[model samples]
Target: MNFLALLLILKIGLSLALLVRPFMMAPTKALNNVMSLYGDNPLIYRLYSIAILSLCVAYGFGLYEALSGRMPWNVIAFGIVSNAGAALALTALNSHPKLRPFEATFATIAAALVLCALAPNYALMSI
Candidate 1:
């Protein structure tokens, strides 16, 4: 019920959504057509999803420890970097007007999560 535990739960949910995005949202034809520059393949997207899945697993463990009243600093640190980077990347991608709404919304979510995590907490180590 602590704030850190809540944050970890949010992060795990986000990572799960990201991991399934390619499979659920991007139809094969769209992927092939839009990313033809990448040789009409979803390989890169799949790899990225795998990476997100890894983060989800890490966040799950962090949440477990957090519920036990332990601060998982390393997982929190990794989450900060990953979420911040995703926010920045999504923001930049929002330049494409066609994708602006989705990209901007997720970017805002990621940024807000990072800000919450960075807030003063006795459990956290130095930023």
Candidate 2:
């Protein structure tokens, strides 16, 4: 349980960090990389960043619900979708490779984080 809790905490930290990085924390070169993947300009990057931040915020909200046992099922569902998106992004590396290495790398890590955070107990529970 302690290990799982630790992993959860780590995931939370990483999610929040990556999600808010472009907006509040670090000024990442990721903006340019994300732009190269599927964006056109700074506005596009900001939009994308907003989406990422929103998902992370959602993840945090779900995490809280999970800990509270009131609504983990919903969060798990969202996490699964997030996982699938990441996996799709990762699989794209083998073909139609438009994303920069950093973008793909981040996607892979984000996918893994979603998987790890939601795997052990999330997959089995139902609403």
Score candidate 2 by lDDT.
0.53
Error of 1 at 94 (Å): 4.7
Top candidate, metric TM-score:
1
Model 2 per-residue lDDT tens digits across residues 1-127: 2322343455557656654565443334555554334433456555666776777677667566655544445554565566566657656644434544435655554564466455745522443
Query: What would the C-alpha RMSD of candidate 1 be, to one decimal place?
Result: 4.7
lDDT of 1 by residue, 11-110 (tens): 6776576445764457567665543434556667777677778777888998787777777767767766776575577566535454445555555545
Would you list the C-alpha lDDT of every candidate in the order shown? Answer: 0.63, 0.53
Please count the clashing residue pairs in each candidate, in the order shown: 0, 0
RMSD to the hidden true structure, all candidates:
4.7, 6.0
TM-score, structure 1 vs. true: 0.68
- Give the Cα RMSD of candidate 2: 6.0
